[model samples]
Target: MVVGLTGGIGSGKTTVAKLFKNFDTVAVYIADIEAKKLMNSSNVIRTKLIKEFGKETYQDNQLNRPYLANVVFNDKEKLHVLNSIVHPEVRKHFQEFVQLHIKKAYIIYESAILFESNSQQQFNFVISVYVDLEERIKRILERDNSTKQEVLNRINNQWKEDKKLLLSNYVINNYSLQETSNSVENIHNILTQKACSIL
Candidate 1:
């Protein structure tokens, strides 16, 4: 089974994904991490990004993330173009990763933009991690060393949490680590049972 896990900025989706890793039968594929790798390693992506945003997109053969982030977050059209170039590659990589974990009970594809990109249809189930906006802003500010306005700009780019919850098969409130872990454990058990029955 393919499950898509998603949440807004600072919603602790990555932490919940790590908790899911504790389950032996579950495999997790993180789209953002893989996308970063592709951006740095894939010549096609490197060329396209540089062409779109200019040579500063990379420096010393590494992705100049701050520059790219500044360009994209400031312009919705630029961010959309960037996603248009990158998401297809990420989806292809995700498919290959899923194939490698074919025998696992289920694999989770964790993406921040799963719903925004309309990629939720690729999953057998969709899970959205939620956190209150103030807490989310606090977390992002600390973790990213970003200003409140900058963090809010990123948050504004994403679909609202309530909209995501409406589309999700399961919703995990991730204010506390213990509570998030418990929710992941419950979901893991349910997915494993469902996958086993299907087999």
Candidate 2:
């Protein structure tokens, strides 16, 4: 079973994914990390990105992440173009990862833009991780070398936390680590049972 896990920037989505991995039966496929790998390693993606964004899209045969981030973070159209080039490859790679973990009870497909990409229907279950706006901004500012406005710009690009929470099968209010860990453990048990029943 494929379980979709998503949260806004600075909502600790990656941290939650790591906690899920603590369970022996859970496997996770992090789309953003894989997309970066594809952007750098895939000739097809590299060619398309360079053609669309110009030569500075890559430097020294590696993705110029800062340059591209500066470009797309402010422009919706360019961001759409970048996602178009990378998402298909990430989905394809995720399929292979899913097959590799077929023996596991369920696998978590972690994407920061799960709802924005309109891919939630592809999963058997969907989980949304959430924190308030101020908390998210504070977290992002501390974690990334980003200005508050830049963090806000990125947050503006995603669906609001409330909307994602309403659409999700499970919601994790991640205000504290111990609470978040408990939520994960509980949900992991639920998913295991749910998957077994489906079989």
Candidate 3:
């Protein structure tokens, strides 16, 4: 079974994913991290990105993240182009990772834009982590050292929490770590049962 786990910036999705990792039957695949690896290592991705964003897209054979961010972060069309190049490869990598973990009860694919990319349909279940906008902004500012406007801009690009909640099979209000862990534990048990029945 594949579970799509998603949340907006600073919604504690990563922390919840880590909590899920504590369960023996579950495997976790972080899409953003894998996409970064693909962007840096995949020859096809390198060629395509260089063609679109020029040589500055990479420097010394390494991804120039700041340059890429400057190019895409503020431009919706450019961001879409970048995602077009990266998401397909990430999906392929995700399928391979799932196949390798076939013995596991289920796998969680953690992505910040699962719903935005219309990829939630690929999963057996979708989980959304929710936090208040003020809290989310504060968290992002602290974690990313980003300006308020910058963080807001990124947040604006994502689907609203209310809309995501309407689509998610499960919702975790992640204001507190202990509470979040408890939610993860409950969901983990539910997914394990579902996985057993499916298998």
Candidate 4:
């Protein structure tokens, strides 16, 4: 089974995903990591990005993430264009990753914009990780060393918790490590039982 995990910016989705790591399921981080790899390795991606956003998008043979972020986050059209380039590559990578892990009982593909990209339809189940907005903002500020408004801008770009919650099979409220870990363990147990029943 494939599970698509998602949450808003600063919502502790990474923390929740880490908790699931102990289950030995394949976890794919669809945005930051995979997208960076695609940008660095794929000449097609590089050329398209330059054509769409201009040559200033790269530096020293690497994507200038901050520069592109500044441009895309402020311009909705440019952000969509960026996502258009990255999501297809990520999805292809994810399909191959899943094929290699077919023996595993479950695999998780985690993306910040799963819903926005309409990729949830591709998964057997969906988990939405959430944290209080104030806590999320605080974590983002500390983790990213970003200004308050900058953090808020990123948050504003993501789907609200309530909206994602409505569409998810599971909602994991991640406040403390113990709470999040326990939630993952419980979900793992539920998945195992369901899989066993199917067998």
lDDT of 2 at 79: 90
Cα lDDT of candidate 4 equals: 0.84
Looking at candidate 3, the ten consecutive residues that score lowest on lDDT are 145-154
Per-residue C-alpha lDDT of model 1 across residues 1-199, encoded as one tens digit per residue? 8999999989999998999888888899999999999999998898899899999999999999999999999899999999999988888888899889999999999999999999988888999999999999998888887989899999999999899999999999997788888888898889889898888
Error of 3 at 105 (Å): 0.6
- How close is every model to the real structure, measured as TM-score? 0.98, 0.99, 0.98, 0.95
46-135 per-residue lDDT for model 4 (tens digits)? 999999989899999889988999998887788899999987887787788888888777887888899999989998889999888999
By summed lDDT, which 10 consecutive residues of candidate 4 come out lowest? 23-32
Give candidate 3 misplaced runs (Cα > 4 Å): none
Distance (Å) between predicted and true CA of 59, model 3? 1.1
Across residues 61-161, which tens digit of lDDT does each residue of candidate 2 receive?
A: 99999999999999999998999889998988998998899999999999999999899999999999999999999999999999999998999999998
Q: Which stretches of candidate 1 lie over 4 Å from their true place?
A: none
Model 3 alpha-carbon miss at residue 109, Å = 0.3
lDDT (Cα atoms) of all candidates against the true structure = 0.92, 0.94, 0.93, 0.84
In candidate 2 the C-alpha lDDT for residue 43 amounts to 93
**How much does candidate 2 score in TM-score?**
0.99
Name the lDDT of candidate 3. Answer: 0.93
